[model samples]
Target: MGSRVMPQGAQDISDPFIERHLVIDTSKVNRNAERGGFTNREQNGVTDQVSSPRRSEIVNRSLSAVKSFGNDDIDLEGGDVEKDRDKTIRGSRIVKVRNQAVLSGLAYCISSCSMILINKFVLSSYNFNAGISLMLYQNLVSVIIVSILSLSGVISTEPLTWRLIRVWLPVNFIFVGMLITSMFSLKYINVAMVTVLKNVTNVITALGEMYLFKKHHENRVWAALFLMIVSAISGGITDLSFHAVGYSWQIINCFLTASYSLTLRRVMDTAKQVTKSGNLNEFSMVLLNNTLSLPLGVLLIFVFNEVDYLSTTPLLRMPMFWLVITASGFLGLAISFTSMWFLHETGATTYSLVGSLNKIPLSVAGILLFNVPTSLQNFASILFGLLAGVFFAKAKMREKSQS
Candidate 1:
């Protein structure tokens, strides 16, 4: 077809394509222009296209074909935009996960350190003699808080049926013994020394795992364990205010702690068997242990002759003492929840690593806060033990990854 040129400033309405082939829908376009979706420059371009057509219909048809084929598929800028959008989404998700893990780790460290300090204060500072009673009170607080949470639907917990209780009873006894001995040891031993001595539990647990679960460890793990033993012995020998009773209690506590760990692993399988869902969660285990400990704790209190001590102790009369003890109880519950959360958010290896490294700051805090008497030799031993713990965790992690 031949084309004709129009006069300057004259509007061309030759084709009238929309009016002839399709119904016109200018209302929505006009509304959009009024709403700013179509800017003044865009509106002027439309007016120019109607008044003075610069390109032919053949060029317009080619542009329409390019648009229909998808500009993003062929254009490098569009591809780059898509990649940037995807990167932004993935980066946001990574940031969220990292934030959660860091928060959970901090919570675990604070609650664990605070719980130990509170117990030490009550036992040594306040001169409280009733270890079993203290444990009982803490467990009672846990039960009360957990029950309230369960009732309010803030958390879920498995029901404490008779079968579940029976399965958990053995582990509960070991758990009680562990807590009582730990409390007793903290009465005389300084927190730093106590933390160093706790490395023994890891060694015992490793040995127990080998024998009972048929698990084997790498040479580095054994080497780390040996370093732990050496550090503990050196720390003890150099301790200026070493108490025979405290060391004895801590040795017993270590064995009990190892037993509790090994026993709990077996008990978990049995516990799950009793549940209808065949799943046992961390909160359920927390509730079970604390709930079952109450009766055993009460029995132990009488057996330990702490009832008379509690009756005569004037510290109980102090509101500040009561407040500190109550806070310890809450911190105990917090430890359980935070530890579980941290382990879930990260992994077992990261949890152990953080736990081992946590003792460094905790030991320093303990020494500074309580004015604990210590020699340079003993302090060196403490640092050695802390490093050994970190090495042990890394060794275990490496061993796990290899297997």
Candidate 2:
């Protein structure tokens, strides 16, 4: 056959193109090479060789899975990133709350301890020994201060009414008794022993909680109470200058302290219900308690013959005496305010436990201030008591977390 050459090449039969012949190029070229040497199942212009429905579906599924796997990687990484961000925000909030609580607790502990130490000074160092009179003045300070604050709108308080007063009057009685007995004990007991004996109050409170609130105690709580009792007995035995009367006063103080706590919890609710201002906060309770205690304290003052002492006392003539006394009053009110703030920010268990923790430093400070005689044995007992307090706090925290 005669044929003309193409522009760039001579015609070959194996070529897919032969321009002069104008042949149709309907053939697959380098089929295996195009598929990277893989099998060409759709050969010979037919795709039925591997066209079983199940096989086709399997291949489609594999391709789809590969495509989706990449998308899933992206989605998973994004989701984890978002989750981590949310966790970071939550962690920050938790840390902030914890810091606030710790700071409040610190304020409460320092203020409370200072009030006690100053009170011990007023009673023991100053030879006041007039528990009722001291309480009366402190309560008067509280009333005056709280009134000023409430009127000035610095702190909101419910208005005092006869109903609310009646509801809180009983708890106020316990509060007064607690204060009086505490002063009596402080007059005779060293600060270290005072703190050791106060562990008994925790026992009484735990029992009261179980009975009043129908709460159950774990074995850990019982063990802590046992340690507290042992600490008290050991402290008493080692106390070189122990006074039976002082110990008796402290024992009474424990009962009244526990009673005041349990009763106050109930009374706070009852008083809140009768409040006219629809706001029965800690300030209102402080006002009601101290304002109502004034009359009772006055009566006790006369009964205890402090009226005669004040009339004859040269301390009344001393400006320093009045200044210290007034300072004690301020600290007392500070105790009340910080105590409420701590309890508001944290829980009751935390408030009570931190209170126990506070007594440790107070005991040391008191011993140093008064030069109260303390042997190593007595110090050991005091340390024992402090350790018990720490364990009790931890147990309480665990219980709270579980609940």
Candidate 3:
């Protein structure tokens, strides 16, 4: 009677059915290895064998379930097996994500530092004092590259609308100001010294975060900020050739630079709403940023009286000049692409930290490549400054951890 008749719903709880849906959590496998998954086997000098009672109990239950299901003429797709496989796939995906993030950060650092050095060479060595003209040309190059990619369907971006452009205008203004002042500052400042001085941007950004967002910094953060200030002052005074105009422009750049990063965060949400694709991708931001800068760049070119120089300059006719500037333009685009890639993969904090970490090598390269005059004291100050940057990055990361 027991074999021939069954209660209602008894089939639902049968071994076959249970085996198909039963999922055993293997998450404890690693934990059990520490204290539970070992057995003594001194006869063969195998002190640790995988014959522990806990492990045997789990294996026996799983095998018994499979055998009972088989006896019942049922095949189990194996819920526990599926789960374990899924867990393995998820673990690999997590590793892949981290690897990509590290690669992105590295690429961003290389492009950013190299772009600065190349631009400095073009402006200083090539005798191109027309910083705005260079910026205009570089931005135009970025626009063209992005356009070609979009047209070829290798990439996609949103169409321009006045409503969208208007929402982005404020951020664009700050961006233009940052770029122009960067050019102005780089013109007269040595690359190493420029990097050291630019540390002030962090201070300005922190102040903006505190005042605007009402976020407070820890004491360690404040101390790091103080070190940055001292380094900046000492590095400034020890400079072999200090340009007042350059320093002033860089100071302005600090504020604008900080403002760009902070404002970009606030505007990103709104910028996404108006895009033709209704998605704000890196290419779209690149397109919008470089495109908007063009008109303003033209105005600045006129305001700075570079048009006359552009018309008469023999460098404009030189193929080598074109080649170098074109390369710089490509590098400029690379910087934008990589910067966005890194920011996207790693978030703002890691992006900022990697940037700060990159300044040391960039500074050393600048001094060596450009043959900038430096004394022991000045070099020490730059070192101190770079270390201060490292400290600040750590402080920010720590504060983030605690919060």
Candidate 4:
């Protein structure tokens, strides 16, 4: 009844499908061998009594048996092919991630070094005494750019509520202090010594971590910190153009920098609670910091009497001056963006490592580009300080991995 009701061609099509999968099993073959139906003659010591046609027939059956085993192997080979394809896909993704990390790190290094050099040119070379105004203008540029990007949906940022602003106010104040002191120090100090002196920030941060967060450090970390101190002192002693005011400002900058880091870490969670998304991204932080700084910066301009200087300075009349300062502003934004990008793509470990290594080229470029006075001893001390930073980063990485 089933055959009678089937379609005209259904039986023929179904026959091959069933036959392909219903090949002879190994157990059936073994049973046949025990029954002496198709056994190997040599294994049983049987004589060649069969005719030549019969022998040819046995050989054909043996070939069919081997082909059956090959069928199973084909399925396994198909699985291996699938695995290889997956591996290829994963390898391509990793390459793409690595490329992104490299690009971000390079952008960070270029923007960072360029920002410092440009600031030095405007402050020292151009003899511009208005550091606060410069900081204000650069930050204004950042605020404008970030606002545009956020509105255009090119990046995501948390909405800034008053609560969030209040939560971040303390950190922003320290941020202002850090930036102002850094600018004052850079105005009088050569770039190389400034870079070396900045190493003290790490020591301060480590101590802050120990005292504030109740964290402990490995002995290797302490050793690296001590080395950093030695290098800073040695560098200062050998500096050919040492300025007491510069050194004092730098010491304050270090403390403020450390304070900014510690305070930001503590306040971040509280700030997030006030945000619409309950998450504050790097862009939001950049926008918030720059926006909040504007009013404070204005007040500072009045206190420092920079408005009169800005009004009278002939450098403002030159289109070239505007171009340079504007470029520095863009580079300032680039530094912020690329630093976050590098950290996101490669994690903090690689970011810290690259940052440590970046000081070397910056030091050399600062001396050569500005022709800052330097002796062999000062250069050695700078190198030592830079190496100490690298050693510190390595120690922290090892300690993190072990923990």
In terms of TM-score, which candidate is strongest? 1
Indicate the residue-level lDDT of 29 in model 3: 15
Which model, 2 or 3, shows the larger TM-score? 3
What residue pairs are clashing in model 1?
none
Candidate 1, which segments miss by more than 4 Å at Cα?
1-86
Report clashes for each candidate as comma-separated counts. Answer: 0, 0, 0, 0
Q: Estimate each model's TM-score.
A: 0.80, 0.73, 0.74, 0.78
Q: Give the winner by TM-score: 1 or 2.
A: 1
Question: Sorted by TM-score, highest first, which candidate order results?
Answer: 1, 4, 3, 2
Worst 10 residues of 4 by lDDT: 1-10
Give the per-residue lDDT of model 2 (tens digit) for 1-403: 0011111111111110111111111121112211122222221233455568898778666655654564442233235654565567667777877787888888866765667777778888788857788778877877788889889989887878898888878877886777788789878998788877877877987888899999987788789889989999999999998999999998998888677666766766567688776546546666777778889989898888888888887877999988887887777677655654565566555555555566667778878889988899989998998788778767766776687
Candidate 1, position 247, lDDT? 97
Q: Ten-residue segment with the worst summed lDDT in candidate 3?
A: 1-10
| TM-score of model number 4 | 0.78
Q: Residue-wise lDDT of candidate 4 within 26-97, one digit each (tens)?
A: 111211111112222222333556568889779656755665565432223234654565567667777877
